[model samples]
Target: MASNNTPVSAQQPTMRRVLKMSEDEIKKQIRSTHNQTKQKLDFDPFYLFDVVKNILNPSIIVVDNIVQGKAKDMEKGNQGESSPKACFIPPCMLKRLSYEMACKVPGEEIAYETTISILRNVLSSYPWHVKAVLTLASFALDYGEFSHLADQIDSSDQLTKSLGILKQVPIVLGRQGVEKYKNSFGKLNTLIKLTLDVVECVVELEKRIDGNNTKDVPELSLAIENMSIDVFWTIITVVDCMSRICALINDKNNTQELLPFTGKITSILKSLTDQIAVCDRQIAEIKAYLKFKRDLESLQDIVEFFKKLIFVEESHNLQQATISNNELSKKTEGLRKKKVLLFFSDFDISEKVVSILKPICEEESRKDQYEIVWIPIVKNWTDIVQSKCKVNEKYFWYVVRQFSSVLGIKYVKEQWGFKDKPIVVVLSSEAKVEHKDAFHMIQTWGIEAYPFTFERERELRNREDWFGSTIDFIPDVLTWMKEEKYIFLYGGEETWIKKFEDEATKVTNDPDISSEEISIKLFNVGKTCKAKDYLGIFLKNLNKLFFSKSQKETELDTKTKEIQMLLSYMNDGEGWVVLCKGHKLVFSGNGTKVVMALKSINDGKQGLHKSTEIQVLLKQRYNEIILPVTCCKFTANTNSGWVHGDCAKCPECSQIMEMIINFKCCHKGHPTKAVP
Candidate 1:
């Protein structure tokens, strides 16, 4: 078979108006050109056509037998196993059709008229696809015989050489004749292949319509509507093909005569191809809808199925979770009747958070009670996501295999109030939403925050002191807590950080300060938070803690207020410090007050005694510099799951802070500035 990739022409033009026309319009157009009474068969002619088609492109045995003077044996009985009699079609019927079709094939003088007359008179009783196939079968017979004879022209047998001369195969296969008609033979072969393709597509469409009763489907309907015009063009092109074959064999006319008909048939082939695609899509959609219906009906566990359905939309087939694609059951079977965390995010999840959660998930104590399933939400599963999934495959307790669901992402956002940030939605075995988002809880308490629920989160919040240790993600903080040391958590630009460190060193090392009674430590919160290994995940988690849905300044949960203050200091782009003495805040100040207080003590302006504790002296001086209008500003991404309240409070005095909406951008090599 010739590859369809062969171009019919440079432009590759197609029949533009045929597919767009209504059924009646197509019939009217057909009537305008070739007004002939089309044919129908009592039973499908494809059964017989298939048998004849095989003989047209016969095997080497058939070729050898035919060339060996056994051609008459084909019509009488089976010549051998490769013969047409192997099929269900009667040999006599194949003989009759081939004889009639060969007789009616158009002559060179009036090729077009004779083709139309054949369609009208002799083959008019057959269906459109049948008409096309019958003509192609007739042409294939001549093609097979001519090809075989040309192959046998140089044979040792005298009978083969004699038959080649009688058939005029030697004249066409001769050196000079070959050069003259090479392009013509190539074109005729391409047209015949293209005709076979169209006839096959037409038959396929008919079979689908009959088998599925899908003729009324819009896509298939439009395809069926255009079949008449498609079939008409195909049959005429086949006839033109036979005419070209006759001209080529007889050496009486130029094979260039088939070019115009080849172009028309190519257009018809393209039309049939496009129609088949539309029909196939419709068939697939119907199949999917039926499958979805069946799945819904067959579902034994609606809760488990609905949970699965939420993540895998209608487009994907619902099956057991495997290492290949989206499924949640098998890997999560141990977590049955327990809380399951659906970790929803885009492909860009925090590796630091994943690293922390991995050990906790693998811990034997908690393995049976809980499980986390990473459901990566994305619009399309691109290569980057695929690579990211591979990189983090072992880190997650369980993750759907290359799973991406835009609808699932939408549901997470609208129903559970998820935003640009990743969220952990907790579901009980009963499939009830235990928590809309427990991501913040996990960040705050790690494994201690087990059965991450709204009640447990509230209980944890109630237990926390307003000024307690929240930066435990850092390793040294636990040591500082054990030592009962005063830790100064501060952040600003590089210059301000250096200045505060120098001032604190001077204040702490002073002879007047009692180093034996008080231990002091300094931490650059901003710089430490952005270490490459952690990648600012600590800062994000801290921000989430502050912006959590449970956060309300008016409520007694002072940890949220402290987190708000810390984040505000970092977001302000100015030097600030908060003093924590053994996991409790002593005092907090901006650079102006904290640095000035240290300088005042260093200059002996406060008249500090030799036995005075450094932290007490520093706090007293810092308080002296405080202003009445204490403003604290915090910046957060609007889409980062921050549930907006009516107002916030100043961590300094518990005064209701005024709210203002400000948009900020921090592009590369530029300071973050607020939009006016």
Candidate 2:
């Protein structure tokens, strides 16, 4: 029932370094920093220790284990991969509380900061009874770490889940534990939110390093300067304190209050004092901006020189980037058209459909009076249009950037076509197989699928009996025809447009009605053709889908799922080593477990799976002390099954997705491997 946020008063400090400062000295430091004068300030030193001593206690490990245990239990139950989440009554007045801080709530004003992330869940938002709760809550909010508790908030059965988590804040983030996050994850900027959380924590430690608790500590600043969003204040303070301490330790002027702080205290305080003074001076200058225009003008003289060089560099980059963006935009736009649907399967209904359209499209000699459309059906397709048009792949993203950029999507969705005409979609053969669901979704509305044969049309149009004018290649010509006039529908949403079949009958009963007069136009993909060399042609065009970011979602989802599953297997219990015979050994999977397993058994990337290497090593290390964790997961290639799962419970909401794992399932619409 207990968690890390519980506050305890006074215990021997584990990472609890302490310092002593005189009342006069503390008063002077606080006054100098705040630009205020204080007379005869009195505070009880013993009581202050009583208040925070437990904060540094070693018993925090017990607190962490208790909380971690709660998490384990949450995962044991089968709620699936994440904690069971219920929709909390959406607090009507508050919206993204982090961004809403400008409203200036009362106690929050004291903790006011622009960079603070909203408390991720209720524990952080309403941390009652717990003293450290308020402080840790403040820290969590400061670094935008509220999201780490997303699983907790979402899984929360009710407000009580949050309350439970609020109880364990203190011990869970204590020095040694906190340092683990700080040193490895913090330095690398692995998780920005996590880093910010650590930054908030380190800031607390940095401000406290002086050990003069009487003075108020400044809140951590979250605004980024240049690219430096992750400098840990703890490292800065330690280095600063050591530097000054080295100089002062040689000077033997030991006093009563600081005698307790002893050597390093003097230098650390001096450095802090100097830095604060400079900051104070800068703040003063910014505050007098208007009044100091003349002085600023002097500074402007230097800025002007820097401005010219910066402008030139920025302008050049923008120009090149803009031109590149324009070309890619044109290519993606070109692919959006009322093109015909061409299938590459022989003896399929596609041939019959193309036969039907040929008389209309190719029979320019016939008075059909309708525009001919061209669509192609190719298998194993992607949304990439670069090689299909031979343009720079990078331009796709650049074109995307020309629009609004947001999380996940760098570019805003671009709508093509004018209100004056109906859009027709061309479906390729591969699309039908990949988007069978999309077809159903369209069928719900009643649209028909069609196919086309541009190869035959090209031959027919090239003959002297034709208009006697040569045209762009069939596919390229169809792409060029789209322009700002029409949008292409892919797969089945086109079927939905045909759902108004009766309306199509009512509006333009004549088969010759122009697309410009209709609200929705359905172009049935009619013909199919078998490619003589499908694989070779497909691979040659693969470059576009492989490189063009126009279809970036396809790439990102694959890579992300791959990485997630990859990390999951590494963290899973499956990647380990155990001795069965006489020696130690490593097991299946790679990365973390593989590296650690190798180190344990003195093995390398020796292609071991399902405990293969470990079984062999067991023959040699039977006499040595070893730890063993069972590995699972069976494959056809090997005669063994390896186990992989992180059976951890939800720390917040108590909901758990059993055996945390991310798999790319085709049924789930994640295509990591080939369709087969």
Candidate 3:
């Protein structure tokens, strides 16, 4: 056989050998191509379909040495249905190609949202089938992408849509068709996993569809419910197909040796089942919550109560206000400006009247000619009225004794109510009034006293019910606030505040005043601003003040031109607003006859006077009226400075009636003693 030329060299690669590749080389080629398709397609179904469309063509694969099939046309490995008529590619070949793709697709990277959106949108356009979605989901698990798959499938809005979709992917899969040939693509672990996954998905989808009958759970409310249904279906499909793959491991005539193939199959199933169960438990809680939602209607009353409190308690605020309107000056134009020396019994009028007086002096429209005795130890009418309830008297002499302190006054306390009490007298004659800054006294000429007013004891019985109202206060406060000429008192008499007290500090007190309509568009502001209705005092005193000012203006007591011009305001009704008792306007009298009530008691007595001689005699001459004596002094007998009985002085001519005097012109005169 070794003939000439050592004939024929060592045999080169034979024709058959040239046509074939080594097992390792074949795997590398398949694996390299696998990575390329998977990278491009990713989780994109349309993209994968496109890749299949591009790379797969007739004659690309040969079956039994005949080039009559595409790569997807290989059915020896397919586990499920045949290819779509459009695809013309067998499902077995598609499974092999897809397995190779998913195996190469790494497990680490997978974003569910992108894949899910594409799947849902693709379904909307082409078909209502869940088949493609389940297939993609199967591929995901092959690459450890179950979570990504679950996330996407759970997008079904309601259980209705989810179950409806689950119904399409086969649940109790036929044991004969795809299941019989699932392991044809042997040794590629990902391929077997993918086949098993698809089958199980179909089954669990069937269970979800079946679970709908109980109607126990709602639409997919939680993340877990959707996952359990979807993944449970996936696990069953995997288990069933993988069971066939288990047999393939023993038949090991194949090119690959997937070590522990059965274990991988079982381990994956365990992982998926456990994950699905966890999802089920989580969803169970969500369902329970949905079934027992609380009734919101029970809290309606309580909510309303707090809403009202929000207005009453929180909206309530204390606001210091200043006197804005100059009705005081305008109304009392013709009145003489003189100092008033009050002889209070138990009444304290200082605190109540101080606020009114500060504005009167600081008012831009007033002439500051008089000063008020800012008297102190001023009696509070309430304290005085509440002082007496005698413990024992057979007929109750203590009743009037209690009211003896009631000086017939009306007032509002910052801490109490607005009640009309009697005018109270001064408990202390020593007025610390001058101590309260004579300069502050110089600003306005009147004292504010809210003490019990007992000045008129008889009338107190008839006017017990007279008080104030706030309805007419808007116009008065508005007039003062609009001009920036108000008196705000942040503190009491100890720290009486004038309108312009802080020269450099800006006015922080916001007097919210309406420039228009008197009472209609009103807003509540400032604490002290509330009880603004002093109508009772003003109305009762209005006509007396109005008529008197008119008479005084015409008569001209000062006999000066400036006084005449100033008093002219009294002749008009503009001056009457301040004196109008908005508080006392009851059903007692109508507008016309109300003016007559203001006429002074001295009205009827004034007719007896003619000239200076008659006034002098009436004031000086003894008229036989017994006078209560001021305390007496001991002239000769003195002990511890105690005094009793009074010293009599002549009322007529500045002469002591009981003391000796020489001049007859200065002698004490009796009413009958006619002096020439």
Best candidate, TM-score-wise? 1
Q: In model 3, where is the ten-residue run with the lowest total lDDT?
A: 409-418
lDDT of 1 by residue, 336-416 (tens): 676678787777778766865666678689677767877776555688778887777677767776554433443566567
Candidate 1: which stretches are off by over 4 Å? 1-333, 347-350, 381-391, 395-397, 402-409, 418-421, 461-470, 473-478, 493-499, 510-515, 526-542, 549-557, 564-574, 602-617, 626-630, 642-676
Ranking according to lDDT, highest score first: 1, 3, 2
The lDDT of model 2 is 0.26
Candidate 3 lDDT by residue in tens digits, 439-482:
21222123222121222221221241222222223464345433
User: What C-alpha lDDT, on a 0 to 100 scale, does residue 594 get in candidate 2?
Assistant: 29
- Per-residue lDDT tens digits for candidate 2, residues 490-547, read 1122333243233323322332223233222222211122633322222222222222
Which prediction has the highest lDDT against the true structure?
1
TM-score for candidate 2:
0.16
| Local error of candidate 1 at residue 207 (angstroms) | 41
Predicted candidate 3: what Cα RMSD to the true structure? 34.7
Error of 3 at 45 (Å): 16
Off by over 4 Å in 2: 1-254, 257-409, 413-676
Of 1 and 2, the candidate ranking higher by TM-score: 1
Scored by CA lDDT, what does every candidate get? 0.59, 0.26, 0.27
| Rank order (by TM-score, best first) | 1, 3, 2
My TM-score estimates for the predictions, one after another, are 0.44, 0.16, 0.19
